[model samples]
Target: MTGAESWAREQGDAYISLVSRRAGEFYRALANEDAATFFKKPL
Candidate 1:
């Protein structure tokens, strides 16, 4: 995770990840906050 964050920093980009609902707790524990909620729909 640190490596990924560092790479993002080097590129001057924000570190973003898509995590499953079940893993939300784990990511939150790592100091990551929920940036947005995504929803899906049948087309």
Candidate 2:
């Protein structure tokens, strides 16, 4: 791919990773009954 396309793909991957992290945190928080702490981190 072109340089610009590569950069876009990288950004997409980063976003997907972030979303996945957030979802995992949210799920864990629900399981543990600590929603406040889950929203406090990088996710």
- lDDT (tens digit, per residue) of candidate 2 on 1-43: 2465468687775311222455666745544333233345565
lDDT of 1 by residue, 1-43 (tens): 8888888899998666775779888888989999888898999
- Estimated TM-score per prediction? 0.72, 0.26
Q: What RMSD value applies to candidate 2?
A: 11.4
**Whole-model lDDT, model 1:** 0.84
Q: Which candidate number has the best lDDT?
A: 1
lDDT of 1 at 9: 91
How far in Å is the alpha carbon of 40 misplaced in model 2? 45
